[model samples]
Target chain A: MSSVCLSMEGGSAASTPAALPYYVAFSQLLGLTLVAMTGAWLGLYRGGIAWESDLQFNAHPLCMVIGLVFLQGDALLVYRVFRNEAKRTTKVLHGLLHVFALVIALVGLVAVFDYHRKKGYADLYSLHSWCGILVFGLYFVQWLVGFSFFLFPGAPFSLRSRYRPQHIFFGATIFLLSVGTALLGLKEALLFNLGDKYSAFEPEGVLANVLGLLLACFGGAVLYILTRADWKRPSQAEEQALSMDFKTLTEGDSPGSQ
Target chain B: MSSVCLSMEGGSAASTPAALPYYVAFSQLLGLTLVAMTGAWLGLYRGGIAWESDLQFNAHPLCMVIGLVFLQGDALLVYRVFRNEAKRTTKVLHGLLHVFALVIALVGLVAVFDYHRKKGYADLYSLHSWCGILVFGLYFVQWLVGFSFFLFPGAPFSLRSRYRPQHIFFGATIFLLSVGTALLGLKEALLFNLGDKYSAFEPEGVLANVLGLLLACFGGAVLYILTRADWKRPSQAEEQALSMDFKTLTEGDSPGSQ
Candidate 1:
C-alpha cells in the first residue's frame, strides 16, 4: 500500500499544483460545517440536548457528527495535507486522530444507550442500532490492528507491506459504514418524531432530510479526495526526507551507538 | 482514467488470479440475492405486489430494487467483467444497462406517484421521494454524458480522457446515493407498517430491518470489489488487442473503403 502511495506521489509531482491543497482545505471546511450544522439541527432545533430526558438522545448525533464525519475525514486527509512532513509523523497524527474519533464515537454510543435505558426503550432493536454497534466494533478492531501493526514497534517490512492494503481498504469501508449508519439513525429519528405522515414540505422534516443529504455529500467528497489517484501526495523529495529520518532513527537504536 | 486502468492491469498481471474472478462472481450473486430478498419481503409479504389500492405501491420497491440495486451494480462492473473484451463492447453494455435501470426506476417512481394520487396522499413529499427523484435525474445525465463521450462516434480522445475519471466517480457516487435512498425508503416503509411503537423484537419488523441491513452489506461488498486497486484487470495484452480493433474499425470507416 505504501508502494501504491509512493508511486502516486511520484506520479503527482508533475501533474498536481499548489492550488489543490487550497481546494482540499476548502472541502474540509465545507464538510466540517455541514456536519456541525446537522448536529446543531438535531441538538438545538430538535430539543436533543436537555438533561435527564429524551433530550439526552441529542448527544448521540452531536458526538457522532463531530467524530465520525468531521474528525474521521480530517484523519483520512492527514497524509495528503502533510505530504512534505516525515512519514512517521504523518502516520502518528493519523493514528491519533483515529483514536480521538473512537473516543468521541464511544461517548456518542453511551449517550444513546443511556437514553434508551432511562426511557425503558429496548436497546439494539433497530437496524440502525445493529449497524451502529457493528461499525463501532469493527472500528475498534481495525484501530487495534492498525496501531499494533503500523505504529509503535511496528511489524516487519514484509508483514507491513502485506497488511497495508487491507488496512486501507477496511479503513475506507468503516468510514462509509459510519456514514450509512448515521443516515439510518437520522431516518429513525425523523420517523419517530414526525410519524408516518412526515412530509418534506415541513420545515423540521426538510431540515433533517437536507442534513442527511449533506452527510452523504460530505462522505462522497471525502472519499473522492482520498481515492483519486491524481490527488496523491507528491513523492520525489519526500522519499529522500523520509529515508533520512529512518536512517537517523535506526542509528540511534543501534546497540553500539552512544 | 484508461491510463490508470491500463497501468493497474499491467501491475495486476502478476498479482491477480483466475480465483479472483470467482470472488467477484460470488459477490455479485450474494448482492443480487440480498436485493431480491429485500424486494420479496416488501412485495410478497408487505402487500407490495397487490394490484389495487395501496397494494400497487409495492411496485416501487420491486422496480427500484431491480433497477437501482441489481442493474446499477451490473453496469458498474461491466468494464471489469469484460476487461478482456473490446472496450467499445463493454462501454455499450454499460450504457445499455444504465438505460434499463433508469427505465425501471422511472416505472418505480410512477407507481408511487400513482399510488399517492389514488390514495389522496401528496406526491414528492417525503425525503425518500426527494432522494429518489434526484438520484434518477443525475443518473439520466450521467448516462447521457457517458454514452455521448464514450460510445457512438465518441468525443475526441482528449475529451474522453478528461471525462473518464469524473464519469467513474459520479457513477459510484450515484450508486451509493441510490443505496442510501433505498435504505431511507425501507425505514419509512417499516416505520409506517410497524408504527412508531416498533420494537426490533417483532418478527416482521426484524425481517424488514434485516432486509435493510442486507442491502447495506450488498452495497458495501459491491463497492469493495469496484474500488480495490489490486483487483484491477490486467492491461498489457488487452491494449494490443484494442488497438488492433481500433485500426481495423478506422480502416473500415474510411470513405474510399470498398
Candidate 2:
C-alpha cells in the first residue's frame, strides 16, 4: 500500500501544482508517529499504568511503529497541502484527515493494551473497542474522500491525476481489516468476558457485537454517502481540468481519462 | 431507494448518455416479479409444498412486497437502458444483472415457504438459503459498481468506488440477518433439537450456517471485482466526456461542483 502511494506520488510530480502538498502530508505523518510513541511510552511506563503479564503490553512497540508509519505517510500528505508551494485547498483538507486517523489509532491502541492488561471487560474494554471502531471509521472516511480523488482523477474533487485505484483499495482494505481485527479481538474479549471473567459477560459481549454491527452499518452508509458526494458534483472546474488532461488521457489509455 | 434512484437519474440526465437505460431496467424488474411470483406458486403448489399454517405463510407478505418493489425498480432501470435512444453497452449489461437477482429471489421464496410448511430442513430449504445468499451477493456488487456512479456523477475510478468498503459490513449484517432467519426456521425444523423430532435435519442446518458465511465472503469478493470492472471503463470514458459538460456544470451546481 505504501509503495502504491509512493508510486502515485512519483507519477504525479509533473502533473499539476495540486500534487505538492501530499508530499508534506506524508512528512507530517512521520512527525506524528514520533510524538505518539513518546506519548504512549510516557503513559505506559511513567504514568502509573499497571503492568500485567497476561496482557500483550509489549505489543505497544509494534503498535507504535505501525502508528508512526501511518502518521509519517499522512503528515507528508499534510505538508503537501499547507506548506507546499503549489497545492489546492481540497488536498489540504483531505490531508489533514490523516491526522484524525492517527489520533484515533493512537488512543484506540493504548486503550486496547491497557484494557487487555487490566483483564477487565467493563468500561475500559468498551472504551478500547469504541476507540478501535472509531479508528476504523475515520480511516474509512479518509479513503472515501482522499483516496477516491487519487483513483478517479478527472472527477470533480479527486486527489491527483493518477489512476491508481489500487492504492485507494488498499487503504480501504486496511480500514476494513482493521475493523475486522478489532471485532475479532472484541469477540474474544466478549466470549472470555475478559473484564468480567468471573461471570458471564454475555450481556456486554452482545452489546459490543450489536454496537460493532451498528458501527459498520453506519460507517458503510457514510461511505456510500461520501462516494455519492464525491461523484454527485458536476463542477465546471473539474470539466476544465478534464479537458486539460484529455490529451494525456488519450495517450495514456489510463482509467483516469474520464 | 426508488425515489433516490429517480433523483439520481434526474441528476445525470443532461450530462450522461448512460442514464436512460436504468428506466428500462426498472421495467424489466416489474415484469420479472410477475414471472417470479408465478414460479414461486408453481414451485409451492405443484411440488406439494403447502404451508404448515396459513398464518405463518401469510405473515411476511410485506417482505415479498418490498422485494417486488425493488424488482420493479430494477426492471424499469433495465427497460430504460434498452429503449433509450442513446444507449451505452455498459448500461445494457448492467440491466441484465436484474434478471440474476430476480431468479435468486424467486428460488429463495419457494425454499423458504416449503421449509416453513414441512417444518423440517429440506433440500429445498438449503437451496433457498444459498439462493438468498447469492442474491445478497449480487446486491453487494451492484451497489459497489453502481453506487459511485449514482453518488459522484463525474468522479474518477477508484477501488473504493468499485468496491464499497462498507459492503463487507452491510454484507455481514445481511448475512447474519439471513442466517438468523434461516436458523429461526431451522430451529422449528429441529424441534429445538430438544427430542430429535427431526434429528435428520440438524446437520444440514449447521452446514448451511457454516457454508453461508464462507460463501458470503467469497462471493462478495468476486462480485466486487465485477463492480471494479464496471466502474473502471465508464469512469475513464466519463473523464473524457467531462469537458463537454462544463457549461451545464457551471450553470447547475450538480453535486459534483463541491
Candidate 3:
C-alpha cells in the first residue's frame, strides 16, 4: 500500500490535524440524525412499520434513508476519516461498507416491491422509481469497478492512474444522484400520503420538508470535506509525491506492462 | 488578472488541447438540449404557457429548468471552457451569466407565486417549493459573494485565495441543489398534472422523466469538466506556480494587510 510506504518513510504528517476530527464527528452526527429523523417521520406520521400491512411501505423510506443516504455517505467518508489507517484497511472497509449499504438498500427495494405486488400497484413507474433504480445500478457498477481496479490484485500502475480521476468523479456523481433520488422519493411519498394537506403545511409535510433539507445539508457537508484539497488523505504533499511517481512510472513504461 | 500576469510571463499552456474542446462542446449541446426539452414539455404537454390561468404555472418549471439548471450550469463552465481567455473577462462573463440566470429564475418564481396567490393556494408549503426557494436564495447569496470577492475590484489577493475554494465548493453544491430541486419539481408537476395516469406511463410523465435524466447528465458533465485536475486553467503547472506565489505573499506578509 502507498500508505504503508508513506508510514515507512515518515509521511504520516496529516495537515489540519485539529479540524478534521471535528468535521468527521459532525458528519457522523448529521448522518445519524438524518436516519433517525427519517425513522421518526415514517413511524410517527405514516403509522408503524410492518411487513404484512401497508405499513411495510414505511420500511422503504426508513431503510433507504439509513442505508443509502446515511450509511452510503458515511462509507464514502471512510477514506478521509481514517486517513492514517493502512490504505488496504481503509479500502477493505470502504468496500465492506458499500456492501452493507447495498444489502440494506436491497432489502428496502424488496420491501417496496413486495408491498406494491400485494396491493397490485404498478412497479418502477414513477420518476422516483426510475431514478432510484438508476442510482442503485450505477452505484453497484461503480463499486464493482472500484473493487476490481483498486482492491483486487489491482490494475496495472498506469491503468490505475488513468482511471482514478474518473473513479472519483463517478463516485461523487452517483452519491449526488442518490441524494437527488431520495429527495424525489420523499416528495412523492409526502404527496401520496398527505394529499392536499401537503399544500397546507400539514405536520407530515413539514416534517418531510425538514428531512429533505437535512439530507441536502448532510450531502453538502460531506462534499465539502471531500473536496477540500488540503484535507486529502496522506496529506496533499504526499499525494502529489505519489502521483509524481505515477507520472514517472507511466512515462517509463509501455502498454505491454498493462 | 492573474492570467494577464501569466500571459506576460509566457504561462498559457493548456493541457489536453484537443479533448477539452469536445468536452466543452458536448457540455454546451447537453445544456442547450436540456433547456429545449423543458420548453417542449411545458409547451406540448402542459398546454402551453400564458400570463394568466393555471397555464402560467408552467413557466415556473420551464424557467427554472432553463435558468437555474441549464444556464447556471453553463455559467459555471465558462472558466474552464475559456481556460486561455483573460481571467477578468471570464470572471465578468461568469458573474453576468449568473445574473442572467437569477433574473430568469426570478421570473419563474413570480409566475408560480402569482398563480398560487390567484388560486388561493398556499405558497412555499411543498418540499419542492421549499427546496426551490432555498436553491434560489443560496444562488443569490453565492452570486453576490462571488461578485464582491472576485469582481468589483476584488478582495485582497490573500482574501480572494482563501475564499475561492469555498466559493467554488458552495457554487457546485448550489448547482447540485438546483438540479435536485428541479427533479423534485418535475416529479411533483408530472404527478399533479398527469395525476393517476402518471403511473400508467403517460407521455408527459415519460418526457419529464427523460428531462430529469438529461438534467442529471448535464450536471455530471459540467462537474466533470470542473473537477478534472489536468483540465484546470493556466495549466496545472502554472496554477501551482500561482499558488506558490500566494504562498510567499501570505507567508511574507502580516494578516493585517489582508
User: Which candidate gets the maximum DockQ versus the true structure?
Assistant: 1
For B70-176, candidate 2 gives per-residue lDDT tens digits of 34234323322333232334344544554454454555466455655566533322222333444456555655555455333444334333454444344333433
Q: Docking quality tier of candidate 3?
A: acceptable
A1-258, model 3: which lDDT tens digit per residue?
A: 011111222324653356778988898889988988988887788887998898998889888888888888888888788776556677789899999999999999999999999999988888899899999999999999998877755257777777887988888888888888999999898888888888877888888899999999899988988887756675444465555545554675433244
lDDT comparing candidate 1 with the true structure:
0.76
Q: Candidate 1 or 2, higher TM-score?
A: 1
Which stretches in model 2 have alpha-carbon errors above 4 Å? Answer: A1-87, A99-160, A194-201, A229-234, A237-258, B1-224, B229-258
The stretch of ten residues in a row with the least summed lDDT in candidate 1 chain A is A1-10
Native-to-model Cα distance after best TM-score fit, residue B153 in candidate 3, in Å: 1.4
Across residues B1-258, which tens digit of lDDT does each residue of candidate 1 receive? 112433433334444555558867876887778767866687556865765767788888888988998889888887677766656677678888998999999888888888988988877767777788889989999988888776645245566667777898899989988988888888788777787456847777788777787787778777877876655545554576546545654765532121
How does chain A of every candidate compare to the true chain A by TM-score? 0.86, 0.40, 0.86
Better candidate number, 1 or 3, judged by lDDT: 3
C-alpha DockQ of every model: 0.38, 0.04, 0.37
Segments of candidate 1 deviating more than 4 angstroms:
A1-16, A237-258, B1-16, B241-258
DockQ ranking from best to worst? 1, 3, 2
What's model 1's lDDT at A161?
A: 60
